[model samples]
Target: MKHILALLFLTAASVMANTAHAENIGCVSTTWRVVNNDKVCVQSFKDPDIEGVACHVSYAQTGGISGALGFAEDPSRFSISCRQAGPIVAKKPIPKKQEEVFTQRMSFLFKGLNVSRLVDTENNSLVYLIVSEKVIEGSPFNSISTVPLMPWGTQAPQFQLK
Candidate 1:
């Protein structure tokens, strides 16, 4: 009986810890706004994998109860901009082409916003693509930002093949 109780306690604690970690890393409410007759708010969060970079994500709210249901019905429309608030040190080199580093649900019905880090080899800069869309439905809007690496330092990693 004691073993069973210990197992149950450990499982519960792990579950709670996972939930807390997810909430901390993904989305956290930041600001609120009034648009038209509805209240529009922006929830800003940073990418867990990338340091010194912050993304400000803003979205409009649809009228409903104050819970998950309400947010689900809300439109998936969103805007994002990633800026280097501090010195960006690449612990691991980022790859060229499109790669989704972070993703979160903006609304129900298969709607989500994804943040991808792309390497601009030609320009020697970093590009971030913010895409918002529904699963079955397509998106007509997207945004991007390019941060040029300072000439003094911050050069892309060089890989030599054997």
Candidate 2:
């Protein structure tokens, strides 16, 4: 039973997770008391399975000695905005909705921020969502963005959605 629960937990955590690496854009000091001031920062990453779509996430990063040493738990306050970096190309078929497309650990353990994607076939757009959660608790703080599907080079995506 213990092994089964562990498997379920791991599976839930990584379901459809692309796990893209973040490229730090920059950071600004939000608090002056700490050496490493608590600051809101922006980072960019691209979808591994879907080419040409990139996302920019901004969140509050913990500061001070703990944050400097990577031992602080960041607050659940982040936003996501996905856009067409170049041409919209889905190497894999877009799902109606997936569990998660991106995830970033807020702390060292089971606490982190998660991003999921939804296909809006009616609007012909892709919607991305961000939610902060913990193993024992969850945050209501969340964000969303959408990218409409259109021709990149000369034609739109050739794939059909269900």
Candidate 3:
């Protein structure tokens, strides 16, 4: 039964596309399993639409028979931190409202991890929020990070959202 479920999730993975592509930074094992080890992992991704900003997220990854086959539902246990890696620059149009910038699957179908960016015009900052979403239920597990658009060595770029 678990194998059947795992197969279904793997099939769905082929069809469902994740908007963000993250590079694994590292992982630390938490529990020992026969096939694999349950671990906490950190992954980093750059904002595709925006330049000079990068985010690193960490979350728990399940292990064991089910997890090894990519069938287990990962917990909505994650945190995010985004920073200005270089001089701030808006590569595309800045939206006035909150915009989803990244997404990763957390479960078979109904659950996912999402990241969004909001331009804080009043504060002259960019706020990034990460949330866990499920189709049938709401999750309170979420995190946020902010980056202030300031001068990097002599270049100060102020932004206006459209």
Candidate 4:
């Protein structure tokens, strides 16, 4: 059917878009269970709109029967680290305030992990933060890391923060 094909195309497009932003770099086993093994997943991603900057996030992933069934919510705690991987360059005007850079579903519904980027114009730095959100409420737990923009080579392009 036309509707079914459209739906499939949209679903595939969304999945591809998410993958373009981030990739699972590593995962570590945490708790053991009869149904499945718990894990802490680590992912590396680049700022979708920025060049020469990358970030890593590590978070606890639920396990066991519920998790295996995609019915579990991951923990709210996570860590983030952002660094200047090369000559920092902003492809577009970056806001001085916080902006959501990346997000991943923590549960099947109503729960997610998000990473935000903040531009520090005065310090010539970028701050990345990780937090958890729920449909009804959000967690106060968060982690942040910073990267200072500096010349990597002679041709380091100017980064603009508006």
| CA lDDT, every model vs. true structure | 0.56, 0.82, 0.83, 0.82
What does candidate 2 score on TM? 0.85
lDDT for each residue of candidate 3 in 1-162, tens digit (9 for 90 to 100):
799778867754653343457898999999998898999999999887667889999988999888888888888899999999988878767897988788777765667888989988889899999998876785898899999888888987645568
lDDT tens readout by residue for model 4, 28-137: 88888888789999999998878888888899999999999999998897998888888777878887888888878898766778888887777877888888888689
Sorting all predicted structures by lDDT, with the top scorer first, yields 3, 4, 2, 1
Return the TM-score for each candidate structure: 0.61, 0.85, 0.85, 0.85
As a whole number from 0 to 100, the lDDT of residue 15 in candidate 4 is 43
Q: After superposition, how far is residue 41 of candidate 3 from its true place, in Å?
A: 0.7
Q: How much lDDT does candidate 1 score? A: 0.56
lDDT for 16 in candidate 1 is 34
Higher TM-score: candidate 3 or 4?
3
lDDT of 1 by residue, 76-145 (tens): 5666666766666554555566667556555542565666777777786677777775647857777777
Give stretches of model 3 more than 4 Å off.
1-18
Pairs of colliding residues, candidate 3? none
Scored by lDDT, the top model is: 3
Model 4's alpha-carbon lDDT is 0.82
